[model samples]
Target: MSLTANLMKTGDAKDGAGSEFLAFTLGSEEYGIDILKVQEIRGYEAVTRIANAPEFIKGVINLRGIIIPVVDMRIKFNLGTPTYDQFTVVIILNIGGRIMGMVVDSVSDVTTLSPDQIKPAPEMGSAFNSDYMIGLGTIDERMLILVDIDKLMSSGEMGLIDKMAA
Candidate 1:
Protein backbone atom coordinates (compact mmCIF):
# COMPACT_ATOMS: atom_id res chain seq x y z
CA MET A 1 0.00 0.00 0.00
CA SER A 2 1.06 3.60 -0.58
CA LEU A 3 2.11 5.90 2.23
CA THR A 4 -1.15 7.80 1.97
CA ALA A 5 -3.11 4.62 2.15
CA ASN A 6 -1.06 3.48 5.11
CA LEU A 7 -1.80 6.77 6.81
CA MET A 8 -5.53 6.40 6.27
CA LYS A 9 -5.51 2.82 7.46
CA THR A 10 -3.79 3.74 10.70
CA GLY A 11 -5.48 7.06 11.21
CA ASP A 12 -6.64 6.19 14.70
CA ALA A 13 -4.47 3.15 15.35
CA LYS A 14 -2.46 5.24 17.75
CA ASP A 15 -5.24 7.51 18.90
CA GLY A 16 -4.10 7.89 22.48
CA ALA A 17 -0.39 7.33 21.85
CA GLY A 18 0.36 10.74 20.27
CA SER A 19 0.62 12.55 16.98
CA GLU A 20 2.34 11.15 13.88
CA PHE A 21 4.89 12.93 11.74
CA LEU A 22 6.19 12.26 8.23
CA ALA A 23 9.96 12.20 8.36
CA PHE A 24 12.00 13.52 5.42
CA THR A 25 15.52 14.71 4.82
CA LEU A 26 16.56 18.10 3.48
CA GLY A 27 20.34 17.74 3.50
CA SER A 28 22.19 15.92 6.21
CA GLU A 29 19.52 16.86 8.71
CA GLU A 30 16.20 15.13 9.14
CA TYR A 31 12.91 16.99 9.57
CA GLY A 32 9.35 16.06 10.30
CA ILE A 33 6.02 17.70 9.59
CA ASP A 34 2.48 16.96 10.67
CA ILE A 35 1.29 14.00 8.63
CA LEU A 36 -2.23 15.42 8.40
CA LYS A 37 -1.03 18.17 6.07
CA VAL A 38 0.45 15.86 3.49
CA GLN A 39 -1.61 15.02 0.43
CA GLU A 40 0.75 12.61 -1.32
CA ILE A 41 4.33 11.80 -2.16
CA ARG A 42 5.68 11.81 -5.71
CA GLY A 43 9.06 11.43 -7.30
CA TYR A 44 10.84 14.61 -8.32
CA GLU A 45 10.49 15.65 -11.94
CA ALA A 46 11.29 18.62 -14.11
CA VAL A 47 8.92 21.52 -13.40
CA THR A 48 7.70 24.34 -15.59
CA ARG A 49 9.56 27.43 -14.55
CA ILE A 50 7.73 30.62 -13.79
CA ALA A 51 9.09 33.96 -14.93
CA ASN A 52 10.81 35.97 -12.20
CA ALA A 53 9.94 33.71 -9.31
CA PRO A 54 12.29 33.54 -6.35
CA GLU A 55 15.19 31.12 -6.59
CA PHE A 56 13.80 29.16 -3.71
CA ILE A 57 10.52 28.73 -5.55
CA LYS A 58 11.71 26.05 -7.99
CA GLY A 59 8.59 26.17 -10.15
CA VAL A 60 5.24 24.47 -10.56
CA ILE A 61 3.86 21.11 -11.58
CA ASN A 62 0.53 19.73 -12.72
CA LEU A 63 -1.03 17.22 -10.40
CA ARG A 64 -4.16 15.55 -11.76
CA GLY A 65 -5.01 18.79 -13.65
CA ILE A 66 -4.27 21.05 -10.67
CA ILE A 67 -1.13 23.17 -10.97
CA ILE A 68 0.75 23.55 -7.72
CA PRO A 69 3.80 25.59 -6.88
CA VAL A 70 6.94 23.74 -5.81
CA VAL A 71 9.37 24.97 -3.21
CA ASP A 72 12.81 23.59 -2.47
CA MET A 73 13.35 23.34 1.27
CA ARG A 74 17.11 23.18 0.83
CA ILE A 75 17.24 26.51 -0.99
CA LYS A 76 14.67 28.08 1.30
CA PHE A 77 16.55 26.99 4.40
CA ASN A 78 20.03 27.47 2.88
CA LEU A 79 20.92 23.94 3.81
CA GLY A 80 23.10 23.33 0.76
CA THR A 81 22.94 22.85 -2.97
CA PRO A 82 19.96 20.61 -3.72
CA THR A 83 20.51 17.55 -5.82
CA TYR A 84 17.84 15.52 -7.58
CA ASP A 85 18.28 11.79 -7.50
CA GLN A 86 16.16 8.69 -7.42
CA PHE A 87 15.58 9.24 -3.74
CA THR A 88 14.42 12.84 -4.10
CA VAL A 89 10.67 13.36 -4.02
CA VAL A 90 8.02 16.04 -3.88
CA ILE A 91 5.69 16.02 -0.92
CA ILE A 92 2.33 17.45 -1.93
CA LEU A 93 0.75 19.34 0.91
CA ASN A 94 -2.61 20.94 1.55
CA ILE A 95 -2.18 24.04 3.62
CA GLY A 96 -5.21 26.16 4.46
CA GLY A 97 -7.06 24.84 1.43
CA ARG A 98 -4.19 25.76 -0.84
CA ILE A 99 -2.21 22.94 -2.35
CA MET A 100 1.56 23.14 -2.81
CA GLY A 101 4.60 20.90 -3.23
CA MET A 102 7.79 20.70 -1.24
CA VAL A 103 10.87 18.99 -2.63
CA VAL A 104 12.97 17.11 -0.16
CA ASP A 105 15.39 14.25 0.06
CA SER A 106 14.23 10.69 0.72
CA VAL A 107 11.35 10.15 3.11
CA SER A 108 12.02 7.77 5.95
CA ASP A 109 8.75 6.70 7.57
CA VAL A 110 5.85 7.68 9.76
CA THR A 111 6.86 8.17 13.36
CA THR A 112 4.51 8.30 16.29
CA LEU A 113 5.83 10.22 19.23
CA SER A 114 4.23 10.56 22.57
CA PRO A 115 3.99 13.90 24.35
CA ASP A 116 6.89 12.96 26.56
CA GLN A 117 9.12 12.35 23.55
CA ILE A 118 8.70 15.87 22.23
CA LYS A 119 10.92 18.62 23.56
CA PRO A 120 10.54 22.33 23.01
CA ALA A 121 12.84 23.84 20.40
CA PRO A 122 15.48 25.86 22.13
CA GLU A 123 15.48 29.57 21.48
CA MET A 124 18.74 30.42 19.75
CA GLY A 125 20.33 31.92 16.68
CA SER A 126 20.70 29.64 13.70
CA ALA A 127 20.33 29.49 9.93
CA PHE A 128 16.83 28.12 10.44
CA ASN A 129 14.44 30.31 12.41
CA SER A 130 12.97 28.70 15.47
CA ASP A 131 9.61 30.29 14.65
CA TYR A 132 9.07 27.62 12.04
CA MET A 133 9.81 24.77 14.42
CA ILE A 134 7.12 22.91 16.34
CA GLY A 135 9.76 21.28 18.53
CA LEU A 136 12.26 18.45 18.63
CA GLY A 137 11.06 14.87 18.52
CA THR A 138 13.15 12.13 20.03
CA ILE A 139 12.83 8.47 19.10
CA ASP A 140 15.57 6.07 20.03
CA GLU A 141 18.85 7.85 19.25
CA ARG A 142 17.49 9.81 16.30
CA MET A 143 16.09 13.33 16.52
CA LEU A 144 13.73 15.08 14.17
CA ILE A 145 13.42 18.80 13.75
CA LEU A 146 9.68 19.19 13.76
CA VAL A 147 8.57 21.79 11.26
CA ASP A 148 5.38 23.80 11.43
CA ILE A 149 4.58 23.56 7.73
CA ASP A 150 1.53 25.82 7.89
CA LYS A 151 3.36 28.65 9.58
CA LEU A 152 6.46 28.23 7.47
CA MET A 153 4.51 28.21 4.23
CA SER A 154 2.31 31.19 5.21
CA SER A 155 4.85 33.18 7.18
CA GLY A 156 5.82 36.77 6.53
CA GLU A 157 9.01 35.68 4.85
CA MET A 158 7.10 33.78 2.19
CA GLY A 159 6.03 36.74 0.04
CA LEU A 160 4.24 38.41 2.97
CA ILE A 161 7.14 40.63 3.97
CA ASP A 162 5.82 43.50 1.89
CA LYS A 163 2.27 43.13 3.16
CA MET A 164 3.39 42.88 6.76
CA ALA A 165 5.57 45.99 6.43
CA ALA A 166 2.63 48.11 5.31
Candidate 2:
Protein backbone atom coordinates (compact mmCIF):
# COMPACT_ATOMS: atom_id res chain seq x y z
CA MET A 1 0.00 0.00 0.00
CA SER A 2 1.21 3.50 -0.80
CA LEU A 3 1.48 6.37 1.67
CA THR A 4 -1.50 8.10 0.06
CA ALA A 5 -3.64 5.00 0.38
CA ASN A 6 -2.69 4.64 4.04
CA LEU A 7 -3.52 8.28 4.63
CA MET A 8 -6.89 7.75 2.95
CA LYS A 9 -7.64 4.92 5.35
CA THR A 10 -6.66 7.12 8.27
CA GLY A 11 -8.87 9.88 6.95
CA ASP A 12 -11.75 7.46 6.76
CA ALA A 13 -11.25 6.38 10.37
CA LYS A 14 -11.02 10.01 11.46
CA ASP A 15 -14.24 10.79 9.67
CA GLY A 16 -16.22 8.82 12.19
CA ALA A 17 -14.59 9.95 15.45
CA GLY A 18 -14.90 13.74 15.04
CA SER A 19 -11.28 14.47 15.86
CA GLU A 20 -9.79 17.32 17.81
CA PHE A 21 -6.59 19.13 16.92
CA LEU A 22 -4.01 20.75 19.14
CA ALA A 23 -3.14 23.81 17.18
CA PHE A 24 0.17 25.62 17.33
CA THR A 25 2.08 28.34 15.56
CA LEU A 26 5.22 28.02 13.44
CA GLY A 27 6.11 31.55 12.47
CA SER A 28 2.89 33.00 11.04
CA GLU A 29 1.42 29.72 9.85
CA GLU A 30 -0.80 27.54 11.99
CA TYR A 31 -0.31 23.80 12.36
CA GLY A 32 -2.15 21.09 14.25
CA ILE A 33 -1.87 17.48 15.36
CA ASP A 34 -4.41 15.05 16.70
CA ILE A 35 -5.08 15.86 20.32
CA LEU A 36 -5.06 12.16 21.16
CA LYS A 37 -1.36 11.96 20.22
CA VAL A 38 -0.29 14.86 22.42
CA GLN A 39 0.99 13.78 25.82
CA GLU A 40 1.84 17.14 27.30
CA ILE A 41 3.06 20.63 26.58
CA ARG A 42 6.02 22.19 28.34
CA GLY A 43 7.97 25.38 28.13
CA TYR A 44 11.09 25.24 26.04
CA GLU A 45 14.28 24.29 27.87
CA ALA A 46 17.85 23.84 26.79
CA VAL A 47 18.47 20.37 25.39
CA THR A 48 21.53 18.19 25.86
CA ARG A 49 23.00 18.07 22.36
CA ILE A 50 23.62 14.68 20.77
CA ALA A 51 26.73 14.22 18.65
CA ASN A 52 26.44 13.03 15.03
CA ALA A 53 22.67 13.41 14.96
CA PRO A 54 20.73 14.91 12.08
CA GLU A 55 20.49 18.70 11.87
CA PHE A 56 16.72 18.64 12.50
CA ILE A 57 17.24 16.61 15.64
CA LYS A 58 17.69 19.27 18.32
CA GLY A 59 19.00 16.65 20.75
CA VAL A 60 17.57 14.85 23.79
CA ILE A 61 15.97 15.94 27.01
CA ASN A 62 15.17 14.28 30.31
CA LEU A 63 11.45 14.40 30.85
CA ARG A 64 10.52 12.64 34.07
CA GLY A 65 13.53 10.33 33.72
CA ILE A 66 12.61 9.38 30.14
CA ILE A 67 15.05 10.44 27.46
CA ILE A 68 13.03 11.89 24.63
CA PRO A 69 14.52 12.96 21.32
CA VAL A 70 13.60 16.53 20.50
CA VAL A 71 13.09 17.73 16.95
CA ASP A 72 12.89 21.38 16.02
CA MET A 73 9.85 21.52 13.76
CA ARG A 74 10.71 24.97 12.46
CA ILE A 75 13.93 23.69 10.95
CA LYS A 76 12.34 20.39 9.92
CA PHE A 77 9.72 22.28 7.93
CA ASN A 78 12.40 24.54 6.43
CA LEU A 79 10.81 27.53 8.11
CA GLY A 80 14.11 28.70 9.64
CA THR A 81 16.06 28.45 12.86
CA PRO A 82 13.76 28.97 15.85
CA THR A 83 14.21 31.87 18.24
CA TYR A 84 13.87 30.78 21.83
CA ASP A 85 11.59 33.02 23.86
CA GLN A 86 8.52 33.00 26.08
CA PHE A 87 6.30 31.57 23.36
CA THR A 88 8.54 28.59 22.71
CA VAL A 89 7.03 25.25 23.72
CA VAL A 90 7.95 21.59 23.51
CA ILE A 91 5.01 19.43 22.47
CA ILE A 92 5.41 15.88 23.72
CA LEU A 93 3.71 13.38 21.47
CA ASN A 94 3.19 9.62 21.60
CA ILE A 95 3.75 8.28 18.11
CA GLY A 96 3.68 4.52 17.46
CA GLY A 97 4.32 3.92 21.20
CA ARG A 98 7.46 6.10 21.23
CA ILE A 99 7.49 9.38 23.10
CA MET A 100 9.22 12.29 21.40
CA GLY A 101 9.23 16.02 21.79
CA MET A 102 8.78 18.63 19.08
CA VAL A 103 9.70 22.27 19.54
CA VAL A 104 7.21 24.77 18.20
CA ASP A 105 6.93 28.52 18.27
CA SER A 106 3.82 28.54 20.48
CA VAL A 107 0.74 26.50 21.21
CA SER A 108 -2.62 27.91 20.34
CA ASP A 109 -5.79 26.04 21.41
CA VAL A 110 -7.46 22.76 20.81
CA THR A 111 -10.24 22.86 18.27
CA THR A 112 -12.66 20.22 17.09
CA LEU A 113 -13.01 19.47 13.38
CA SER A 114 -15.62 17.25 11.85
CA PRO A 115 -14.66 15.06 8.91
CA ASP A 116 -16.52 17.30 6.51
CA GLN A 117 -14.49 20.27 7.67
CA ILE A 118 -11.18 18.59 6.86
CA LYS A 119 -9.84 18.84 3.34
CA PRO A 120 -6.98 17.04 1.62
CA ALA A 121 -3.62 18.80 1.61
CA PRO A 122 -2.88 21.00 -1.36
CA GLU A 123 -0.17 20.01 -3.79
CA MET A 124 2.73 22.32 -3.16
CA GLY A 125 6.08 22.07 -4.98
CA SER A 126 8.89 22.43 -2.52
CA ALA A 127 11.64 20.66 -0.62
CA PHE A 128 9.19 20.15 2.25
CA ASN A 129 6.50 17.97 0.80
CA SER A 130 2.88 17.60 1.91
CA ASP A 131 2.93 13.86 2.47
CA TYR A 132 3.23 14.46 6.20
CA MET A 133 0.13 16.60 6.11
CA ILE A 134 -2.95 14.58 6.92
CA GLY A 135 -5.39 17.31 5.98
CA LEU A 136 -6.32 20.93 6.20
CA GLY A 137 -8.65 21.71 9.13
CA THR A 138 -10.77 24.82 9.16
CA ILE A 139 -12.51 26.39 12.12
CA ASP A 140 -14.09 29.78 11.72
CA GLU A 141 -11.71 31.79 9.58
CA ARG A 142 -8.50 30.08 10.70
CA MET A 143 -6.81 27.20 8.91
CA LEU A 144 -4.86 24.46 10.64
CA ILE A 145 -2.34 22.29 8.83
CA LEU A 146 -3.11 18.95 10.37
CA VAL A 147 -0.10 16.66 10.54
CA ASP A 148 0.24 12.88 10.65
CA ILE A 149 2.74 12.46 13.44
CA ASP A 150 3.34 8.81 12.64
CA LYS A 151 4.40 9.63 9.11
CA LEU A 152 6.46 12.54 10.37
CA MET A 153 8.37 10.16 12.64
CA SER A 154 8.34 6.80 10.94
CA SER A 155 9.61 3.58 12.47
CA GLY A 156 12.84 3.77 10.49
CA GLU A 157 13.52 7.28 11.79
CA MET A 158 12.54 6.32 15.32
CA GLY A 159 15.04 3.46 15.15
CA LEU A 160 17.84 6.03 15.10
CA ILE A 161 16.83 7.21 18.56
CA ASP A 162 16.61 3.63 19.77
CA LYS A 163 20.05 2.95 18.35
CA MET A 164 21.42 5.99 20.15
CA ALA A 165 19.90 4.72 23.38
CA ALA A 166 21.44 1.31 22.91
lDDT of each: 0.87, 0.83
- Once fitted onto the true fold, the runs of candidate 2 whose alpha carbons sit more than 4 angstroms away are 1-17, 155-158
Of the candidates shown, which would achieve the greatest TM-score relative to the real structure?
Answer: 1
lDDT of 2 by residue, 1-166 (tens): 1422333344445545688778899989999898778877889999998999877788999999999899899988889778999989998889878899999999877667888889999998985579889989988898999988888888366568766645
| Steric clash pairs (candidate 2) | none
lDDT of 2 at 70: 91
Question: For every model shown, what is its TM-score relative to the native structure?
Answer: 0.91, 0.86
lDDT of 1 by residue, 1-166 (tens): 3866776776777766898999999888899999989998999999987776778888888899887888899999989899999999999999888788999988988889899999999996978999999999999999999999999999865653223212
Tell me how many clashing residue pairs each candidate has.
0, 0
| lDDT over C-alpha atoms for residue 113 of model 2 | 87
* Top lDDT hit: 1
